[model samples]
Target: MLDYLKKSFARKKARRQFQEYSHTVSKFILKEEGEIAFANWNNPLVTPKVISQEEVNFFKKFIPKGALCIDIGTNIGDTTVPMALAAGKTGTTIGFDPNPHVYKILEENVKLNRDKTNIAPFPYAITKDEGEFYYHSSEASFGNGGISNEIVSDQGAFQLPQKITGINLEKFLEKNYRALLPKLSFIKVDVEGADKEVIGSIGNLLTKYKPVLVAECFTRATSEERAELYNIVADLDYTLYYFSDFDENAEIIKLEGPKDMNRWKTFNFYAIANAE
Candidate 1:
């Protein structure tokens, strides 16, 4: 009973800290091999240097110059900026984020690096179809935002449901990026728990471009949903590799099959197209 009370107190204290940080905004210079200017509220734990340096290194090694890339769930341009830089001036990095509040930050961050990187920010959510949906934007944790049809965080003290525009990936790509499809080199997805939906919507694009795909899978998805995601990649003739970190030397464990992911609650993975 005494230990339980201590644990409860600790949780309450952590919650208080989260609330405090949520209302605070600050700017910092994020430095890894390169430097990025960043600002954030409610996300003291995130910075370009810490979470994305390894990813940047990995992209530098794999993504060719002048490549076209996509960044889904581009929160404040942390990953987008690095990818844009890696893509060089001739290349373009398109980013999507539906949360209005955070999308503003994403825009600002993109502008902050405008002179150095080629990044375009889109204020729309990627879904299986075009429509409007309620976005659950969490106040305490900014990254927990998700569409009404998808799973979102329930741990926050407060959340606002804001109606946002959703874009069908296939249709949008056809209309806007069709000409660049051949140059598409990489696609990064981190749409909370809705990765499967996004991947499903872009089946044709994946088949045509066969860009390297990096996606985040949440443990909250059902076993069937997980299987569907794995099958989708497999059907595309892509080999699966689990991403252990952003480090250039991060472990890239190849999975023989989808069952290999059953035990992890959340994991990042890479899907590389098999040679034709």
Candidate 2:
């Protein structure tokens, strides 16, 4: 009876907040776990969407054996685990996710695959500087959001009150993952909408290592922002491939130039540095 009343009250309050604020209330406590999850944006019902998948095989084909890889915004370690496994026990896959709610689950998943996969999880947002900053959640609910940009929804208050530190990815890797730099052959960035900033912060590494890059051009981002993503990678001599789905078999639309990007929909794109 007590638990029922409590849950009933919570639901009523949630509805009230949704109606009043427009954006769903951000709930920080998240429970349960899944092998895979979709880090969707503007979801008021949940922060990270969970689904069942016994195996993650999409990244194995992209990640070479015994090669180092990195996954930014690794919600629940879904992509991170596969990258780690693909890299083999001899290699390492470092994942960075600042969302504490999901980061906890990622940490647990990392442990479960420790025996067979080399994984490292960090609860920090990737940025150009090493300092504390605000982490905002747009259209959030019970734990979901993308990027720290102050994008307001139809609801009044979309930015949640949370602080996450920014880590200089290049410096962090140089200081810690130095030994593995030579083997850094793959990098995947799915940080909502800050893909370019993350890429820019590590520009030197990308230039030096010339790793395979996979980044999401977020649906909420502006056209210029998406175009810049193209310019950044193209300047580095990468051939771009855009795909709508995460499936390895999904049809790919090759991007010939900046004008070809269709930002009306959400998509993940990949690029390979032209072999020197």
Candidate 3:
């Protein structure tokens, strides 16, 4: 009975917040003057829409204009907008997410940033192979971006289930954009706990393409898994950088300190090519 009450309270709260957000977005649309004013500005899951100006500047500096950037686990495309903005009118930003509910929001977000010349939103997951996989429902949290079947819960807040088609990063890149391979300049991967698999699957692409990578390596990754990740990155001859603090609110920082990024933390790094 207690648990039931708690869930009921949670549902009520979620509905209230969603209503408030709906009002805010409606007002903002009415006040604004643009071609795409009807486009929604809120994330599918209410992950706080707070991004630091400094972080935006960092992305703009690291990601080149006219370069192709692939964002894995793009959730509802919040990051895609800023990335597309950073890439400017000439660049292409591809956002991939398999969750059907979130993919709808991702599509909406792409429309929101329609002024951004070349942004493509794909409803797919970049994994080891082409197959069907289950996606956990996002419970209005940014960390709930994407979850595998093992971590999904039916009775809990996450109740949505999605069967997604996966793609091997290397093979997908070759098949879809073989001629434009050289233009692939940066990649931001954050596929929940499947980071290792995603990184491993794209090993050849990283080594061959040499694109700058900013991956979200949050907790839940084992030390050995982290080591494996490091080795793979090292094999590509790429240098790593770590963010100072990583939390829902903690901004992604580009460290300028003396400590070598490899030794600091298991996660949070900007792996740049040796030549660049």
Write the candidate numbers in order of decreasing lDDT.
1, 2, 3
Name every residue pair that clashes in candidate 3. Answer: none
Better of 1 and 2 by TM-score: 1
lDDT of every predicted structure (CA atoms)? 0.73, 0.70, 0.63
lDDT of 3 at 107: 73
lDDT of 3 by residue, 1-276 (tens): 999887677565654342223312221221122222223434333534543344444667667778788889887665676677667668888888876655676676666645644678887889776887666543542225454545556423453444667877777778887776788888888877576678878888888889888775656566666666666676677766676532223445454432333344456677887885
Per-residue alpha-carbon lDDT of candidate 2 for residues 146-223, written as tens digits (9 for 90 to 100): 544444453234454676778998889989989889999899998877788888888888899999899987777677
Superposed model 3: Cα runs more than 4 Å off:
1-45, 51-53, 137-159, 245-267
RMSD of each: 4.8, 7.2, 6.4
Best by TM-score: 1
Clashing pairs in 1: 54-246
- Which candidate has the highest lDDT of all? 1
Per-prediction TM-score to the true structure, in the order listed: 0.81, 0.77, 0.73
Model 3 / residue 230 / CA error / Å: 1.9
Model 2 spans > 4 angstroms off: 1-55, 139-142, 146-162
